[model samples]
Target: MRFFCIALAAASCAFADGVGIAFPQENALLPAVKRTYVIGAIPAADATQPLTIAGVTNDVYKTGAFIAMVPVEGGTNTITLTWGTNTLDRTFRVAFPSPPKPAATNTPPRDVRKDLGIPPDEEVSDARPKGKRIEDLTVMIDPGHGGQDTGALMPHGAGEKTVNLLQAQAIEAEFAKYGIKTVMTRTTDDEFPALYARPRRAYAEKVDAFISVHHNSTAADRDPREVRHTAAYASTPNGLALAKAIQQYVGPQVTGVKNAGAQMRSYAVCRNPAVASCLLEIDFINLPEGEDAALNDADRRSRIAHAVLIGFLDWLFAPDDGT
Candidate 1:
């Protein structure tokens, strides 16, 4: 009986070959997922080396090794592993619990304008047509595509407008954290104001800068391969500086997403009241390769959103950064 037990133990060890994995994968999930992945073997041994873990966040990685998988988002996905020449396969399933959204920061108790030497434009800045210049500046964020207009729709029904609004909200939260004055075009699920009206409100409020958040869609005939790229359009000629800064910062953060560069578009806000203005068409819409899903993902997309906010603030305070 002892010898039989020993033989069984050795057999079990010999067959323990591989494992599988998914990405954005591990723990903590969000509604949007970037990609689904499969990792075949962990700690692989062929002509021979030890196995190492490989994934987006994992520190360890090996060419032919894989082990254990934790789900980040989406439903329970199964990974099949085939072992060696015999082509034996093993499967495992995991539950993916949705990660909680980040909490929004509360408004500061006091405004920063008091220390900046410029008077606050409080509501009616019409009296001072010249506009106030503060050490810190005020910005208005407008999210394009709202209400019944779904903008562009992906195969999975991800909407560009929805992404824009969410991106706008995430950026505003960050701007508030830095004590910059901010005005928003619309906050809820209401119809967006007409194109011309958007900048009018910003100009009326004496906003220092106006940013319009939107997504651009390309025609399938020309872009059959489903191109993914980031771009910015400036109404004011001077606003190109802001556009370039945003493209430089936000583009790399999105990874595989391309940069269309700072483009010049004659927009409604460019000629309005001399306030600098820019429009950002984040990426091509309804891309077949889950581009919308990637942008909608809170973990990754929020980083892009935060980057846009940082680019503007960085431009405002550190224009001398030698872009």
Candidate 2:
């Protein structure tokens, strides 16, 4: 039996022959909840034998991808996967969240803003040459997670992958109104483009900007009802600017959710150095309200799509700090 342990987010492990777990990295600290998902793949050569996790036989797609929601409890949880003669074991820790302390009634409201040392903006001059027109610019839209990788599955609604594609299509349609050209990484449900390849396609197509759409999911221990927000992420300064712009426009348009703000994270899709790239977590799909809006509310999705386009335009036209 091969054993591995990891704790960082988005970590994955594979054996020498390419069979391995792709998510929930080994030695992860999870919420004290009843169940969590395990995503992995096995070699096509071993297709004749069944792939079992914790003794439960899972149906592996032709692409070898498989995802299973498995039972987990508080304390140390060990997950074992068996494919033919190969056995892999991953360990995780589940802990309940500590209760929040009561707030003091006498305490005053706090100012949330802090100094980010951003330079003052310069006024645009009519003499300055006009930049490229919106119609001349091109954007690449990537719908995250597809095929056997279902992303975060909602209890009462469509999976994250499905909603991601839907929102991407809506965004594409909204962009069309402005004559802005848009290229999609995948337009169908069955397409599962490689994570790294998504950005490469953007670079090859010479897109001015890249946006990856996705829904967020919390650990099992957290109450989905209490969590509702939209977040954006990027790895570079330019990417951060784009992310912040998206957060500004997309957050408020989603009626019930709060703006969680932009963050710096090195996601694979957001690492495109050729152009500004951002990954948008439009909403927490695990929540019923969030899922409902994403899966059922057509107007809400269109509003979000328009907001995102506006955010992109705002960022593109903003005066540069000359960093």
Candidate 3:
């Protein structure tokens, strides 16, 4: 059968006959694997026959959705899809897994400190409040997703919910070093707190700050490799200040990832008017590199938690403009 070639970068190309591929966007770089699934749809009006990819037949639903597993090699691979009399081709690259490099020390770049106006010799105690005792300060920590609400999942089965809890616990441990008390929404993976309840808990505790820890994920249509970064979001003035502090301190700790900067977003867990709240999107966990550095690396996770603690401390010590 003659096949019409679609550009590698195109997520879907509509033809006169109404056949399209919906996922594994064009020129996408995927983890090195022997097989991968291709998902797409044919117009229901034209779905007269079963769809096949790489010679494997896939059952098309009544709505025309079809998914089929196809074999791929270490380099560029092509997938051929056939339905009825139409044929289409999609090409993507499967990146070979790189050899593990020697672990590097998790040190924040000197420029990061300088940019934040912190001297190299400064200690956390130096930023302590003047009249207020550190022991009296309290903060609320909300790990983003839990239980069945697994925020994002990698191909190998690691869930973002587990990573969020781990990072939150690490941050809590760091905060403890300064005598700061932290209240977590839920300490275990089995507990799933409602989104609205997270901010309510922060307000009820009268905490000095609220931080919701989370990892990011790219949309199915986007290239995961192009969207790895650190971001923070806030809804109110106080939240903005807290988010900016996080962006300044935690941004550089992720090493190669770019800091996408603090943005204004009214996320459910960060909109508490009574408490300074910020949601930290540590990195895009959908990317393999991001998954390894942000989720799997224990030392890197601890360093990120320490950076977050430092950022919160800095925010607490800044002069209040009475917002």
Candidate 4:
């Protein structure tokens, strides 16, 4: 009897190998906005037993698979899957959504011109560098997403990868005119490197600055045309300065693009400690106008490229900081 029990236990272990929880990964941070589906593959040996998950009985199919819609409340929720004596479980957090801000008022905004302490007729000084040159600087340009990763695909069939490569190429061309050396993470549409690998190239090349180009997307319910903004992101303080420079120049150069300002974000490419880095969201690709400006129009692409080059030059030669 003891020898027979040992053989049965070994068989159970082999069957357990086929059982797995595929979705709502172990110790995952799940969004609390809506109920999520818990999907998994069940072993045929455990198919006869009732599968209890978080007090709910889940129905398993003959094909040894199961899918259940689980309501996730805010805070930690322990999910337990049990089939007879064999059990599998995982703990995950359902984060609380941030509170919505108050709606904007209809009143006209107050003018802050009085706070400038300058006469309205006085001429503003030129912000561009006069004699500074970046001939010795080497910049690394990253065109975000490519190949299998077609990021932010619009319903109209526009892909962000195409625009990213186009913009990166144009930027490279403009930088060459200033005698500044430039390198790209990807020069073609079919090449896609891992996220960390993109910034690692900058360190390997010993470049002074890194910029990743990308386009923006909106929620499914919102109309893309209603929201068109140009934004820049950086992780470090020096990177923030570069982001600000890009925002200041590229925002206006893109014609219809609204200046969303520079934001500090800890993105993978922007977190490289060895080089100053920023990610530029040139335009919203989902919208018709943005699609025309960012991808379809050659003149707009050239203008944006020139604007980015000018922004980098401004950052490199800013009188107040040590670049």
TM-score versus the correct structure, for each prediction = 0.55, 0.62, 0.61, 0.59
lDDT of 3: 0.71
Which pairs of residues clash in candidate 4, taking residues 3 or more apart in a chain or in different chains? none
Q: Model 2, residue 202: what's the lDDT? A: 71
* Model 1 pairs in collision: 25-72, 26-71, 41-65, 41-66, 42-65, 42-66, 43-51, 53-60
Per-residue lDDT over 1-323 for candidate 2, one digit per residue giving the tens place of the 0 to 100 score: 23643423222334534346644666778765778766655665555568798889977655455656788888888899877556678788888656876976888642111111112352211111127788888889999999888897553324699999999999999999989999999999888998877876776676788999999887655555466688899977778888887788887645458888898997878766566789999887654356567877899989999899998888877786211
Task: Give the per-residue lDDT digits (tens) of candidate 1, residues 91-194.
Answer: 32334445787976986743223322224664322111123344357788888867777675543344567778877887788777767677778776567676
> Which is the leading candidate under TM-score?
2
Q: Order the numbered candidates by TM-score, best leading.
A: 2, 3, 4, 1
Better of 1 and 4 by TM-score: 4
- Badly placed stretches (over 4 Å) of model 4 are 1-133
Number of residue pairs clashing in candidate 1, backbone atoms closer than 3 angstroms, sequence gap of 3 or more or interchain: 8
User: Which residue runs of candidate 1 sit more than 4 Å off their true CA positions?
Assistant: 1-136, 224-226, 290-295, 318-323
> Top lDDT: which candidate number?
2
lDDT (CA) for every model shown? 0.54, 0.73, 0.71, 0.72
Please identify model 3 stretches exceeding 4 Å from their true place: 1-131
lDDT of 3 by residue, 1-323 (tens): 22374434333335533245544556778886666656556666545587788888777655455555667788887788877666787888888878988988987643422333334675422122335667988888999989889887543345678889989999999899878999999899878998777876665566778889999876544445566788899877778888888778877655458888898996777666567789998887654456557656888888888888887777877776422
